[model samples]
Every structure is written in C-alpha cells, then in structure tokens.
Target: MELSAGKFLCLFALLSVVSAEIFFEDRFDDEWEKRWVKSDWKKDGDGAGDWNHTAGKWFGDENDKGIQTYPDYRFFAISAQFPEFSNKDKSLVFQFSVKHEQKLDCGGGYMKLLSGDVDQKKFGAETPYSIMFGPDICGYSTKKVHAILTRNGKNHLIKKEVPCETDQLTHLYTFIIRPDATYSILIDNVEKQSGSLYNDWDLLPPKTIKDPDAKKPEDWDEKEYIPDPDDKKPEGYDDIPKEIPDTDTKKPEDWDDEEDGEWTPPTIPNPEYKGAWKQKKIKNPNYKGKWKAPMIDNPDFSDDPDLYVFPNLKYVGIELWQVKSGTLFDNVLITDDAEYAKKVAEETWGKHKDAEKAAFDEAEKKKEEEEKANEKNDIDDIDDDDDDADDTDAEDSHEKDDDNNKIEEEATSTHDEL
Candidate 1:
C-alpha cells in the first residue's frame, strides 16, 4: 500500500528519532561484558537457577531468552570483577532495581557493592561492608522507596527514603561514586543525598580482595616446565663479569670549606653583662592604719607566715563623711600582677580585709537560707510518715469491729438452737 505524502514524512521522522536512541550494549566492547558475574538467589533453593532478566534488556545474561523467575523472599548479588581494576579504577557506579515481596524485618536484607573474594574458598567469613538501608520495614511504610550510597570503604552512608508503592512494578536506584571520594544516591532518577570523606587525611583505601586461587598468574601450568638445578641457580650469574663497573676514581683526602667557594658562613656576636643590685627586703606594719612599706619589725602584726604591705592614701579632706566615716578597713588587698609568693603572703596577711568581711556576711545569709530549706523538707517527710501511720491504725480498727460482729451473731444462734 502506498502512503499519502504527509504519512510518508511522519514515518520518516519517527525512524530518525528511533535511530538516535542509544543501546547500552553497543557502547561497551564485548570484553567489557565479561567483567560482570551474575549471582542467582534461586540457585540456593532450586539447583536449576534463573534470574528475572526481563527487566534488564540492555545487558544480556548467559541464559537463553533473558527471562528468569524471582524467589519468594530472596536476594541475588551480581558483582563486576575486573582483576586489573585494582590498579585501574578506584571508584565506580553501581545501580540496580529492587522490589520486595513484603516488609520483612527491621533487619531488611542489606544490599551492598562488596568487593571481596567472590569465590567460596577465598570468601571471607565476614564481609568488609554490608551498608544498611533502614532499621527495618517499620522504619518506613510498606510501600516505601529507599536508596543509599556508601563510600570510603562503606563507612559513610548517604540515604534517601520516599513514599513508594511496592506493587507498582519496578523502579531504579542509582549511585554515583567519585574518585575524589564524594558519593551520592538517586532514587527513580531523582537526586537525593550527597557526602564526602576526601578531606579526611587518614582515610582507608577501598579494597576488594581476590580469590586465593587468583593470587598466581592464570597461565601457571605445573606440567609445562621442569625444575632443573642448573636453571634455578641465580638470575644474573650468566653476565656477572660484564655487569660490574671499573673502579677508576680516587677518594678525597680531607674536607675543605674553600673548595666550594660558592657558599659562605656568617660572623658571630659576643655576649655582654650588665650591673646587678642587691634586692631590698620589705616589712609589714603593726596596725591597720596608713599602708606603709612595712616597718623593719612589728609584734602587733601576727607573726604567722604573712607579710603585707599597706599603701596609704594621703589627701587634704574637707569633710569627715568624704573620708567614708573613719575609714573601716577589713579584708586584705593586693595588686593584680603580684607573684605567686607575693599573693600567698598577701592572702595570709588578710589582704582586702574589708572585702573578706562582706563575703563572709553574704555566705552566712546563704547558709541560713539552706538550713531553713532543709528543716522544711524534714517536716514534710515527718508529716508523710504520720499520715501513713494514721491510715494503718484506721484499717486495724475496722478489722477488729468486723471480728466482734461475727462472734456476737454466732453466740446468739447457739442459744436459740439449745
């Protein structure tokens, strides 16, 4: 059948659009495809294993038709192995889809991009990481969408949870991990959380252990070569004489600064001393009068290891009230920059005596208040005990009355019967 002119153009445009669509398999070489190793969770149950590969048409599996069944409540782990990847790549992006049969436990089965021995013999008893997604199904509603990305050996986790309907087919979870050590998680193609540990200087390198069998070269065949004693002697013995260098240069006799005139040293300066004087000794005043550079000796001042210097303030006073009504000095006083020894001496001598007196008065008032609070608490406790005792007495009296009534009734009945 021949199409109309407009129909032909429409068909042509549709084909052009389809041609632009990218096929994932076309981008990577066939060798790259071999890197992936598929794991079947169903294999653990039915020896004849399969996977639900219908959802991933971009990447084909070893199974024909690319269709498989999913287990009732099981998880499958697929790992991408690149033996050379150890030296080639440090960071990678692993994205996949997950649909649970039901909200199981707070211990929702964990999915992790683990890099360790995939072989059972070399597989470690404990994996280096099993980064968790949530506490349990209770952590979110039954139909919830969650995505998490763990980086820097899975120590750091970036998670995002959204309302999702479990029955609503399949959805994608994507993670992008960078070499700079920043990781991000995306659920359903929408960006979620992003974090980094690149700034931490003492970070551990992400590692994936190989199977013990993989320690040696793949081509190592014992039958190919025979061990001969002569062949096993040493590597360089064949050309040892030719490998040695001739000793022709003479050794230097002594070190000489002038030999290398390109460098120079600077002159040094001599030390100088100044005059020193004998330190003067100070004394304390006998009474709390004007503060004087302490007198040579005074008995009225306590002999206890205290040395105080009282400096007097001299002024021509106009009124008695201006001098603070006869200058009442109580506590000790000392300069702010006084040395430890000087401060001890001043404190022992009761420096700022007036200040100390005021402090003592305030402390006395606080003590009285505390004593009153304690007495009130004690009285409240006593009242509580008295009320308890009164209730007990009342209960005992009621019991006694009950017994007396029963006894009277019994005595009356016996008399009637007789």
Candidate 2:
C-alpha cells in the first residue's frame, strides 16, 4: 500500500478532476422514475399531461430514450433532486438536448435549477428557481434561448436576444456562467451568445448615465439645416387651383337644365397645380452639432462581486404550459467543465443527429404518402356515391315510363269498350 509522493499527487489530481467535471448528470435511463418526481399541481383540474419514456417515433437509437410530453394543451410539472452544491467560485455549465417532435408551435422547452429543498409534488411555475435556461418557442415571433438568473429574490432575464434552433430534430443547448461574471449561450456546441452579466442583465443599475444636472445651452444651434433666406415664392404660385372642370367632358344630348340639376361637368385634378412649396434647406454655418448631456458615473450603481454565484442549487425541474406537446428532454448535465458538457453533447446529439434526421425524413415521407392515399380514397368514395345516385335516377325514370304506358293502355281499352 506504499505509494510515492508523485503517484499520490497524480491520483488525487485525477479524482479532483472527475469530481469537478460532473456535479449532476442524467441520461434518463430506466431508473429515471426513481430519481424524478412528477408534480400533481394541475392533475385535479383540466388534468396534468403525462410523460412518456421513449426515443420518439423516429430516432437514431431506440434505447437512447428520454422523457417526452405526451398530450397537447396541458400543463406539465416535474422535478428531480441531486446532492446540493453551489457555483460560488466555479464555472457552472447547464446543458440538455431537446427535440420538438410536434414542431413546438408554442411552448417552453426550458429547465430550472432550484436552490434549497423543493416540494416536488407542488413544484410548478410559481416555484422559485436560481437559474432557468433553454429554448422557448412561440409561433414565428418568439424563438430564443432563455438565460434567467435570480438575484435578491428577483429574476432577471438576459437583455440580449439569443436565437435558438426551432427544428423538429434534436438540438443541444448549453449555458455556461463563470465566476468572472461572464456567460455564454451555445446551441449545438456553437457559441450563439457571450457577454458579461453586468451588461446583459439589469441586476444592477447602469455604471454610467446621462448627467441629470447638465442641460443644452438656450442658444445652441443643434439644427444642421435652415431655410434659404434668398428663396421667394413665385408670383402665380397661389393662383393655380388644385382642381378644375374637365375640358374633354361634353353635355348630354337629352340634357335639360331644369330637369338634370344644371348638368355640371365633372372636375379633375389640374395638371399645372403642384403641392405647397417650401424654401430649400441649406447647411447652417453656426450649427454646433447635436447636443447631448455628458455622461457621468451613476451613483446608484454598485457592483456585486458574487453576481454569478448561485448557492445551494439542488433540484432541476421542468414546468411549463404547452399548446401542443411532443417535446423530448434528455441528456441533462450540470457541471463545472464546459469541455465535458460539449463532449456529452457531441456523444449524444452530434453522434446521432444525422441518423435521426434520416429517420425523421422517412417518417415525413410515409406520412405524406398516407395523406395522399387517404385523399384518393375520399375522391373514390365520392365518385361511387355519384354513380349510385345516377343508377337510382335511371331506375326511377324507367318506372315512370312503365306507369305512363299502363295509363295509355287502360284509356285505349275504355275507348274501345265505349
């Protein structure tokens, strides 16, 4: 059991690396139900949507399954707890993969990280969270990654618009926040957005603001252009009427002044008339440029050294209202290493993406063919109905003719008898 100093240090370093890389991870294996708790928040009313553990209708691997929203127009709430940890002086990376199998017309595909203990059964939208990140899609207007951070009991949304993947295929979304107050948003392992927390969120007042006491001088010539003093209105400019009687119009042949209400000619816009004129603008020599209040350091602004810290993060939850369901969430990872997250994304989403696309395309093709076949069947049914109606009409016509013949025969026989 004796070991050299170098060997012991190496083993300790390896253990630290492994521990630091992964804080919480879930591939959503068969034992997911043991770890996850489905909330009964909306179960009594309107019914809470259920989650299906499957790889979906089309996927690269059948066994690579995830939890999917099963029904449309229902609220879903679920949470899973992990050993509590904090990102006090470390880089925090939160990532997951989502596939909007229903095309996600309007719904939230985001996940929340909650601090402290949670009432899993009651976990819903009202439950507080330390950080919320992922894609949120709604029609054509809203398709962006949400990166919200909670500070002082208030949630602050990222000010920058970071667009996300809206495709039906699976996509990897990664959000990374560092101890230095910088953050990044990645979609499919590509950096979509990166900036400082102070600049991106309104957690603190602005560092600089327009000087409240400063004002533009009363005689400051801010206007860049002024009316030409030499310009004057023409003598006949006001004389041209906007409308005049059309000379091409003629009086009707049957026109009677008393009967036809004087037979006035229709009016037309005058060709010679022009809109109201203004003196041409010329550059002003005394222009002092656009005046602005000088900026000064904001007195209300106070930077926090621990802006990126989220202490006691414990649970990860999914709580949202979906208009149309079929969003699959899997490969959830919370770590301190960005590279490890990327590797996880590449192994799951990247490795299987192409095969998944191929499967999706095949499914689409099959669906299209089925739709066309159904349309054809409907058309044939309509044709068959028309043919049946025609046959019935022909039979009715023949019966009517036989009745006419019988009546004519009876009349002839009576006449002959008479």
Worst-scoring 10-residue span by lDDT in model 2? 12-21
lDDT of 2 by residue, 123-150 (tens): 9989999999999999899999999988
Cα lDDT tens digits, model 1, 326-362, are 1111111111111221323233222332443354456
Q: Whose lDDT is greatest here?
A: 2
Clash count, one per candidate: 15, 0
Cα lDDT, all candidates? 0.35, 0.92
* Top candidate when judged by TM-score against the true structure: 2
TM-score each candidate. Answer: 0.28, 0.86
Count: clashes, candidate 2: 0
Candidate 1 CA-lDDT value: 0.35
TM-score of candidate 1 on Cα atoms, chains taken together: 0.28
